[model samples]
Target: MTLDALRLEVPDILQEDAASLADLNEQLAEARLQPQEHALQQVLSLLFRLNRSAMTLLERQRALQSFSEEYRHYAAAYCAGVAPPILFVRFCAEIATGFKRLLLQILQGRQPSRPHLAWCLYMAQHFLAQSLLRHYQLYQEPPASLWRDSHLLYWLGEHQECLDEPVAAAFQPQPANTLRGLYQQMLLLALSNPFHLAEGESPLLFSALAPLASLARLLPWDVDDDAEGQTVDLTESQPCLAYDQAPEGDSHYLRRFELGALLVALHEPAPLQSALERQLLERVRHHWLGRQQRRHARSDHAGDCSLVVGLTAIHAQLLEHRPGHCAAQMLDTSPGGARLLCHADQGRLLPVGQLVLLLSSSATPTLALVRWRHLNVEGLHLGLRYLKGLPRPVWLRRAPSAQTHPGVLQSTPVQGGGWHHGLWLPNEQFVEEENLWLQLPNVHNQAALPLPAPNLATPLVARHPLKLA
Candidate 1:
């Protein structure tokens, strides 16, 4: 690709290394006689270089995809002592940090430190996270997956076990699976090593360590959000939830975390929560919502459960779940019904207006907001008509963007036009979705994305996913 191409559409997508990547693969094939110890190291280096170049090529998505296998394998081996993974991890973790910083500089439009140099460092460590995190479970191997076992991770801390309470009225509980615990783990470990690039320290020397530093920040998954259903206006009588539901924790905790990150410390890590704690809290909310659901037994009323999640610690959602149709008895007894069509899409996202329109789905178009469910009421409603979809909402898709790259935990940013998980470090651009970067015609504002035509499947470049511990 031409240099202008790099500056233009996919500034980070580096394809020049294709032949080199292929050459390394060939070398791996022929190194059959090499000692397993040396072979493993060589294999990883080659894979890392390939991945790094992908980042350079704006093939972050592909690089990440390619790196997953090597990433996990080496990680599993290192933690398990099957290989010298600890020292290796430490090395990579140190380097990863620099790459992350470079991403930030690029987003900020500051001159890139060792331009075209970071692609290698970041990818090498990133793939390591992919390879290792899966086996993070193996590191604490036992009866089953860590997803079901709290004993999978436990440490004896000298300090108090309870979290340091905030200095304010605690906010409501977050949805269900904030995935904070998993995210934090990624952050702390990836940055496992930190160096003081002091006065005498060379920029090249520090730059060389970026990939390792970045490793500490490799996040495996986005925050656990339920598939979005349709978003709802708080004023409405009821609101629909993200089909999957939302993460759990103190609503205030998440709110505080977001508030802290937005304007100040973008590199800092948030808090953590456990499934056991989240589950217990959900039970409490079920009681509070005055709705109970049995495992096997169908509820006389579906989804009577309610919960709240906020966007930017300000956009609050008090979502409730109920039967798709009216109460069972009412559905069977009611005779005639009305038909209406509701617009699935919302009009312009009016910043200030509390617009609630339920495009009726029967025969004619209609807009209706929820009113009190009086005992005298009569009607049959199929699905809900909320203003928007839930976070972790089903079909959670990032809208098309103009350009893209690999950085941070790769969370879908929770902004509009799509979900914003992570931010673009180069320009300080925080895109809700990966494609958003590709949607921008110009990467100048750091707000717009270069998107392909809506009909075509936008090119998804491999983004090195960062796991923020």
Candidate 2:
């Protein structure tokens, strides 16, 4: 499909590149030998395309299941020590790739049934947490994105299950530092009923109201919340709930009548009950308002620097071929979102509301929602809201800008290339998700580079530095 034909319209309707993706999937399925690395990437690219397509929920589930099963087999073999190293590596990478695509879909507000969502979530957790994590410590140059992304996926699965079932955990009163923690806290804030905290609320009320907990999960802080059904505004005469005789169309109302009734009973209550209710409301307010305010917070860094940002489909684009990375100029970043400038060609294709992965040296790759786009004299400016995560603390310095090359684990590139003056060093600690670097020092003296013993030496690359030359 032509690139211009790939523009993502609001209320996303992605153009399917089904023929090419199907062909790639067919090739992958039929391959008997250990497929090449490019083939693995092709499969991942195809999976991305499929998720972006306008497939029905069942169709998407079936297709995803088929791909998940295929990779699981490879993972099983790799764990068994039978699969080739290349195949195993590809399996690990593809699992991360698939999970990211799944998350982007979720960010787009694609609602699948609980069972189907559970199945997909289960597969993702199995691949990333249960399988890939076991081998994560072994890689010398792992993708830093994996550490944070995996945690997010794990929490999403856990959250999906716990929304209806007994919550396996409670909200800690502590501030959340990570994206996973923030989401975990949000789930608890949104789904936990404050009235249930009373010691003797009565087993009868809890038992009768159990089902409502499943269907009426409410986010009291949401902006679209009905004014009449707001929790804080509940009264004895006008409880914040749709009555039993309410119209069928009002059934989806966010107000939980059962919970609201209990809230009214405890509204003027014993100190303990009042305190618990206050605490719940405080958390809800904090997170809700925090989300809005963080989006526009100030940043100290320059907004026009070249930041290494990863890009997936911001909605869906018809690419003749998938590009390795997106070149985006960092415009501005707040705790909640970022503004980026990109070439018109790339920016025009991204649809507002689509999620994309933005990677940088300062922080792990973030899943961000496209909120707005505009063309001006400067370029195509895109606004992105970070999804369910906060950026790293502002005080922590971002790594300085430098050229980087991705290398295979435990291996180094050959010498004689650009930036040879700097040694290939592993992180002070062996972090499986951070990449090894070929750093160039300002001194430019070859003798200053750390030359480890042969056994410890990494592969070196030999390319002339164009500017230096």
Candidate 3:
């Protein structure tokens, strides 16, 4: 279904990007022989369409299957040499769109069976190797013998621990220096479900491919932790952590799954001796080592205090929660932003790059962007970065006066604390308890503030211009 049918709004940036790509497509069409900007637009357009469109769990899966089938046809044609140059572009487009869709589906609670997962992996490898081959042929001035020592196969061979036995064997049949063997190996790896095999399952391929693991740890698996799926209720509203059901976690684990994979490759009985492979390995090692020194600092204390965040109009579909604001507990604070944990069973929210409104009692609402998200058994640990300098509330900005701090008004903290670990209420009474209260900074002021919570226990139901003593 279209975005309109799901009542989802499309972002202007996406539309502009698509429009720019359309212009590029026209240019490419004019110069048929020019491989200047081959298929980048088509790949991105497919991604945009898939993300913007709202479909049921079933429909999304089916759409991905269709793309996979289309990719298979292209792969076959390309193998036969009868495939046109554009077919390579089409194949990559399908690969990009299909792989991204599969990831999003997993986030939205669609678990693929083992066979289906295998198919996806196969398709990913086939398209990726071909795309690289095509890029070198058309864009780069590579030597004719480049195919004799396919760098792509060399790259895949190092990560055999991630491939199932059947998939690994797929590579053995191909003679050295052939692309077909590498493609066949990856395809077989995708077709085989080594879920039952201890060494075969690596569902976190995206993180391995990520540029950095420290700041953007996409998804990490706890080898011993249960992998059961969490039941989500899209219609239910999550109570504040004060209501007692908040998930618990002090620090987000920051281990490099790729680093672990790399170590295995290094320890292999027959390590890669190729100069090119050695150079790539050394580069990757140095890069990750540098990342280790640049880790973000996290605070140890965000105790009992929760940070209330609201969904802003200028957000992507990534973090769109049910109709209104949702509350998140601060796990820790960093110099630029903070890490928070929110109830995931309420439905997955907060993908990277989503903008959210951070409401602080003493300060103005801070706008933050989701930088990273780690899904766990408890919920999602989101890493956010504030967009601008932190602003103080109007009252905090002005000198405190006796008239503004009436005793009666000060006596009653609008709401008592709830079961949430970090309970934020509408009044300052609970402020000393490491709890945060939200309200207009100025009591005498009637202006509508950009923040959401007031000094009342029922801020969720409270209106603007809250009444204070």
Candidate 4:
């Protein structure tokens, strides 16, 4: 069926001069005046209408480019903390709908020009990537409808022999040439467990995946194919299905992809340009190819606990006995980590990598890191990894003459099984390779400790583990 037969009639404003860029600018200016969420909805609707009304492929591509630009603006705002989470999610959904409709329009009967076809496919892949990112951020499953649409698009692209056609968009850092590259990129990012990333890091990791995606490979799957890994069932309306657990029946739509090339690229030193990039690559390797198994097994646990978020709040609660605790329910637990559920409002303050204190009636207060998080209709779900040893409140400074800052002193097990002490201080107070003075509670003397490079750092805090003689 053709998209035109399924689409609603274009609005009056778009019918006459849908190709006119000036009209679009004017309408967008008016949209900016409305509330952000409402404004985005209107803008997206107008852009799609413009695309639908276009008489030529050039006009449609122009409209799509404009759509891409406006989407980037809102995405940046959400990442910068200027826009609310609800608006970000709505923006993703609207853009995905717009892209799907436009792609269907492009794929109809008459073959489009190569450039236009490539651009549409590229944008479709981009839209899918963003949708996956939204799901990762929300800790929700990607809608099956989205996967169905994506599979259909890929199937059609393959039939047209345009899956690898190259297209360059101004917003992208590099040319997006292949639908398979983008598809594999999305899968790699998903396997990386992006919910564990700190705020503002997801976008960077997404960008990094663009260049490396080409190294990954996707192939048709057969029942006899002996690859003992994950498989993509193009016909299944599911997200991230496993190879072994695929449906009992065989179908031509089954496919498999390998990340060997990508893993080799990650292992090379040259591809890692920054520490953060290196860390993200390491995580991808660990999740996809590394043989490291979970250190501790988890069991179902049920109880309520009090939680305090952030290094500042934790320090205040521990040292000053301040009232910053929020109620949370334990869902499951292990010696190494625990999963908890809390109200969304409380979860907002606890981003991934955040330092939180868990207090329960049966045990003493425990320190943990926010390893991952998800929000849904019920509430916020948190995955926490416990920090070793009991934490004691301490005052830290560069020197005795310098101003003191609140910090936590804790001991963690070293590789050979000895305890090593570290200080957790707010990000602003941490200095690389500098010596810091620690003032212990009820002690008159302050101890001088050399601050080694932090093994773990987040936007809110840094952990400096000290090596003693």
**Compared to the true structure, candidate 3 yields what TM-score?**
0.28
Worst 10 residues of 4 by lDDT: 2-11
Best-to-worst lDDT order: 4, 2, 3, 1
Candidate 1 RMSD computed on C-alpha atoms after optimal superposition onto the true structure: 24.9
Residue lDDT tens for model 2, 316-412: 1112133345677886678877778887667434544343657666765565556655554576677776654322111101133444332111112
User: Candidate 1: misplaced stretches above 4 Å?
Assistant: 1-19, 28-33, 47-60, 76-87, 90-179, 186-469
Q: Candidate 1 lDDT, tens digit per residue, 1-469?
A: 1111012111242445443443443565554357645656666565445433433324443333343333344434433222243334433432332233333335445443332323332232232232233223112111121111111111100011211111121111111111222222222222221111111111222222222222222112234533211222111111112324453433221211111121122223323433432332233222212233433322233222211211211111111232132212212111122122122121111111111222223322122122111111132222222322322211111343323342221234445545423221222234323444222222233333332222211011112222222
Output the better candidate (1/4) by lDDT.
4
RMSD of each: 24.9, 20.1, 21.2, 4.4
2 or 4, which is superior by lDDT? 4
TM-score of each: 0.22, 0.28, 0.28, 0.84
lDDT of 3 by residue, 104-188 (tens): 3443455445444444434444445444334322222222222222222222322322233223212111211222233332222
Ranking by TM-score: 4, 2, 3, 1
Top of the candidates by lDDT? 4
- Better candidate number, 1 or 4, judged by TM-score: 4
